[model samples]
Target: MRVAYNEQMNALSKILGEMAGLAGSAMERATQSLLQADLSLAESVITEYDQIAALSHQAEERAFALLALQAPVAGDLRSVVSGIQIVADVDRMGALALHVAKIARRRHPNHALPEEVNGYFAEMGRIAVALGAAAQEVLISRDPERALRLREEDEAMDDLHRHLFTVLMDRNWSHGVAAAVDVTLLGRFYERFADHAVEVGRRVVFLVTGTLPSDEDHEIDLAHGR
Candidate 1:
C-alpha cells in the first residue's frame, strides 16, 4: 500500500510538470501572436485554454482523492496540499496567456505593440517564457537550490515592468489612450505571469525542505504588482 501511494504521488508530480509545459507553450504562442499580429495563432491559443483548465481540475481532483483515501501525512501531506496550490497558479498563468492572445485577435492585422516600444514587450515575452521554463525545472527536479534562483530571475521581469510604466508616463508619448491601455495591460499580464512562476518555485522549495519560506520572501512575492 505504501508503494502504491508513493507511485500516485509521483504520478501527481508528472501531471503537474505536463501542465507547466502546456501553460508555457500557451504564453510563448500568445507572445508570437502579440508581436507578429497573427490571428490564427491567437485563435489557437484561445481555443486550447480549455485543455489547461481541464488538466488543472484533474490535478486538483487527484490531490484531494489522495488526501481522503491515503490520508497522507507529513511530507506527503505537504506535497498534496502544495500541489493543489501550484496547480491554481499554473491555471491562472494559462488564463493570463489567453488574455494576451485575445488582445492580439482583437487587433488583427495590426500589431498590438506600437513600433516605438515593441522591443520592450518582446523582451518581456522572452522573460515570461524563460520564467515558465524555470518553474517547470523546479517541479521536475524539486531542487531547492534552483528554486532560490527563480527569485533573481523574477527581478528581471520586475525591472522590465517598471520600465514599461516609465514609457507610458513619458510626456512625448504619441500613442493614444487606447494604445496606452493595451500596453499597460500587456505589461501587467507578463509581470503577473512571472510572479506566479516565482510563487511556484517558492512552493517547490517548501516541498523539498519542509520549511516555509521566510517572511521576507513572502513580502517579495506580494510586492510585485499582482
Candidate 2:
C-alpha cells in the first residue's frame, strides 16, 4: 500500500510539472502579446485556458484519490494536501495570463501608453515569468526554504503593481480611458499572478514543517514606501 501511494504521488508530480510548464508558457506569451500588441499570441492564450483548467482539475482528483485510496498520514498527508494547493495556484496563474491577453486585445491599435509605463510593464512581465519558474521549482523539490525565498520576490512585483497604478491615476498623464483601463488590468494581472505564486510557497512551507502556519503568525512586514 505504501508503495502504491508513492507511485501515485510520483505520477501526479509528473502531470503537475507539465501543467506548470504549459502555464508558464501561457503567461510568457500573454505578456509578450500585450507588450508587442501581437494579437495572435493573445488569442492563443485565450484558447489554452481550457487545457489549463483541465490539468488543474485532474491534479485535484489525483490528490484526493491518493487520500482516499491510501489514507495518507503524517508527511504523506501533507504531500497530498500540498499537491492540491500547488495545482490550484497554478490554475489561477493561468487565469491571470488569460486576463492579460484580454487586456492586450482591448488596447490594440491605440498602443501601450505613458512611454515610461512600458518599462514598468516589462519589469512586471519579467517578475511574473520568474514567479512561474519559482513555483515550478517549489513543486519539484518541495523545499520549504526555497519556497520562502520565492515568496519574498513577490514584494518587488507588488511594488511595481502599485507604482503602475499611481502612474495611471496621475491627472497629467494622458493615456485616455481605453489605455488607462488596459494598464490597470495589466497591473492587476501581474499582482494577482505573483500573489498566487506566493500561496504556493506558503504551501511548500506547510509540506516541509508538517504544520500549516496561520497568516496571523507571519512577521515579515513590508515598508510600503514604493
Candidate 3:
C-alpha cells in the first residue's frame, strides 16, 4: 500500500512540473507577442490556455483521489494539499499570460507600448520569465531555501511596475489615453504573473518544510540577529 501511494505521489509531482513548464512557456511567448506585435504568436498563447486549465483540473482530481485511496499522513498529506494550491497558482499564471497575449492581439500591427517605455516592459517580461523558471525549479527540487529566495524576484517585478507608472504619469507623455490604458493593463498582467510564481514557490516551501512562509521569515529574522 505504501509503495502504491508513493508512486501516485510521484505521478502527481510530474504533472505539476509539466503544468509549470506550460505556464512559463506561455508567458515567454506572450511576452514576445506583446513586445513585437506578433499576432500569430499571441494567438498561439491564447489557444494553448485550455491545455493549461485542463492540466490544473487533472492535478486536482489526482490529488483528491490520492487522499481518498491512500489517506496520506504527515508529509504525504502536506504534499497532496500543497499540490492543489500549486496547481491553482500555476493555472492563474497561465491565464495572466493569456491576458498579455490578448492585449497584443487587440493592438495588432501597432505596438502596445510607446518606444520610450518599451524597454520597461521588456525588463518586466524578463523578470517574470525568470520567476516562472525559478518556480519550476523549486517545485522539482523541493528546496525550501530556493523557494524562499524567489521573494527577491517578486520585488524586482514590483520595482519595474512602479517605474512603468512613472513614465506614464510624466507630463510630457504623448501617448493617448487608449495607449495608456493598454500599458496599464499590460503592466498589471506581468506583475500579477510574477506574484503567482512567488506564491507557487511559497507553496513548495510549505510542502517541503511544513512551515508557512511567514513563519519561515520569522525564523530567518531570528537567525540574522534581528
Candidate 4:
C-alpha cells in the first residue's frame, strides 16, 4: 500500500510538470502570434489550451484519489493539498495565455501592438516564458530555494509592465485610445502570467516546507496602474 501510494504521488507530480510545460509553451506561441499578427499560431494556442485544462482535471482527480485512498498525513497531506492549489495556478496560466491568443486573433491582419511598444511586449514575453520554466523546475524538484528565486525573475516582468504604462501615458503618444487599451490589456495578461508562475513557486515552497511565505514576502501588488 505504501509503495502504491508513492507511485500515485509521483504520477501527480508528473502531470503537474506537463501542465506547466504546456502553459508555458502556449504563452510563448501566443506572444509570437501577438507580435507577428499570425492568426494561425494564435488559433493553435487557443485550440491547444484544452490540453492544459484536461491535464489540470487529471491532476485534480489523481490528487483527490490519493487523499481518499491513502489518507495522507503530515507532509504527505500537505503535498496533496499543495498539488491541488498548484493545478489551479497552472490552469490560470493557460487561461491567461488563451486571452493573449484571442486578442491576437481579434486583431488579425494588423498588429495588436503598436511598433513603438513592440519591444516592450517582446521583453515581457521573454520574462514570462522564463518564469514559467523556472516554476516548472521548482515544481519537479520541490526545491524551496529555487521556488523563491522565481520572485526575482518576476520583478523584471513587473518593470516591463510599468514601462508599458509609461509609454502609453506619454503626452507625445500618437496611438489612439483603442491601441492604448489593447496594450494595457496585453500588458496585464503578461503580468498576470508571470504572477501565476510565482504563485506556483509559492505553492512549491509550501509543499516542501509546509509553510507559506509571509504576506510581505509574497507577490507584488497586482493593482492596475501600480
Candidate 5:
C-alpha cells in the first residue's frame, strides 16, 4: 500500500510539472504575439488554454483520490494538499498568459506596445517565462532552497513593473491615454504571472518543509521590495 501511494504521489508531481511547462510555453508564445502582433500565435495561446485547465482538473481529481483512499498523513498529507494549491497557482498562471494573448488579439494588426516601452515588456516577458520554468523545476526536484530562490526572480519582475509605471507617468510621455491604459494592463498581466509563479514556489516549499512561510515573513519580503 505504501508503494502504491508513493507511486500515485510521484505521478501527481509529474502532472504538476507538465502543467507548469505548458503555462511557461503559453506565456512564451503570448509574448511573441504581443511583440510581433502575430494574431495567429495569440489565437493559439487563447485556444490552447483549455489544455492547461483540463490538466488542473485531472490533478485535482487525483489529489482527492489519494486523500480519500490513501488517508495520507504527515508529509504525505502535505504533499496532497500542496498539490491541490499548486494546481490552482499553475491554472492561474495559464489564465494570466491567456489574458496576455487576448490583449494581443484585441489590438490585432497593430502593435499593443509603443516602440519606446517595448523593451520593458520584452524583459518582463523574459522574466515571467523564467520564473515559470523555475517553478516547474522546484516542483519536480522538491528542493525547498531552490523554491525559495523564486522570490529573487519575482523581485526582478517587481522592479520592471515599477519601472514601467515610471515611464507611463513621465511628463514627457506622448503615447496618449489609450496607449497608457493598454500598457498599464499589460504590465499588470506580466507582474501577476510572475506573482503566481512565486506562489507555486511557496507551495512547493511548504510541501517539502511542512511549514508555510509565515505571514510576517511574507510581509517582511514585501516591505523590503522582495
Candidate 6:
C-alpha cells in the first residue's frame, strides 16, 4: 500500500502540472485576444475553462481520498497535503485566466486596445505565465525559496499596471468614458492576474512551512492614482 500511495502522489503531481500548463495557455490566449481583438480566441478560452475547473476538482478529490485512505504521515502526509494546496492555487490561476478572457470577449468589436496599452497587456501576460511556471517548479522541486522569489517578480507587473493608469488618467487625455471603462477593466484584469500569482506564491509558502499567511501578510501594490 505504501507503493500505491506513492504512485498516487506522483499522479497528483502530474495532474497539477497539466493544470498549470492549461492555465498558462489560457492566459496567453486571452492576452492575444485582448491585444489583437481576437474575439474567437477569447471565446474559446472562456469556454474551455469548464474543463480546467473539472480537472482541478478531480485533483482535489484524489488528494483528499489519498489522505483518507492512506493516512499519510510524516513526509508522505506533507507531500499529499501540499499537493492539495497547490491544486487550489492552480484552480484560482485557471479562474484568473478565464477572467481575462471574459474581459477580452466583452471588448470585442472594438479594435484592440491602443498601441500605448498593448505593451502593458503583453507584460501582464508575461507575469501570468511566470506565475504558473513558478508554481510548477515549486511543486516539482518543493523549493519554497524559489517560489518566494517568483512572488517578488509580481511587483514588475504591478508597476507596469500603475504606469498604465497614469497614462490614462491624465487631464489632457480624452479616450472617452466607454474606452476608459474598457481600459480600466483591462488594467483590473491584469492586476488581478498578478494578485492570483501572489496567492499561488502564498500557497507555496504554506506548503513548505505548513502554515498559512494572514491578510496582513499582503503588501498592497495599488497605484497612487487609486
True-structure lDDT of candidate 2: 0.79
- Candidate 5 residue pairs in backbone clash: none
What digit string (tens of lDDT, one per residue) describes model 3 on residues 76-176? 89999999888998999999999999999988999887888889888988888888888888878888999988887788787777777778777778998
| Candidate 1, run of 10 with poorest lDDT | 217-226
Q: Score residue 18 of candidate 6 by CA lDDT.
A: 80
Stretches > 4 Å off in candidate 5? 215-226
Clashes of each: 0, 0, 0, 0, 0, 0
Q: Top model by TM-score, which number?
A: 4
Which residues of candidate 2, in runs, are more than 4 Å off? Answer: 112-114, 213-226
Q: Rate the local accuracy (lDDT) of all candidates.
A: 0.86, 0.79, 0.85, 0.89, 0.89, 0.77
lDDT per residue (tens digit) for residues 69-188 in model 4: 999999889999999999999999999999999999999999999999989988999988898888888888999999988987888988877777878888878989999999988988
lDDT, candidate 5, 1-226, per-residue tens: 7998999999999999999999999999999999999999999999999999999999999999999999989998999999999999999999999999999999989998999988988999999899999999999999999998898878888887877787888887898998888898888888888888888888988988888864322212222222
User: On a 0 to 100 scale, what is the lDDT of residue 89 in model 5?
Assistant: 91
lDDT tens digits, residue span 30-71, model 1: 999998999999999999999989999889998988888899
Error of 2 at 214 (Å): 5.2
lDDT comparing candidate 3 with the true structure: 0.85
In model 4, the runs with Cα more than 4 Å from the true position are 217-226
Model 4 scores worst on lDDT over the 10 consecutive residues at: 217-226
Instruction: Give me the overall lDDT of model 5.
Output: 0.89
Quote the positional error of residue 16 for candidate 3 in Å.
1.3
**Per-model TM-score versus the true fold:** 0.94, 0.90, 0.93, 0.96, 0.94, 0.87
Which candidate model has the greater lDDT, 2 or 3? 3
Candidate 1 backbone collisions, by pair:
none
User: Model 4 lDDT vs. the true structure?
Assistant: 0.89
* Minimal lDDT window, size 10, model 6: 214-223
Clashing pairs in 6: none
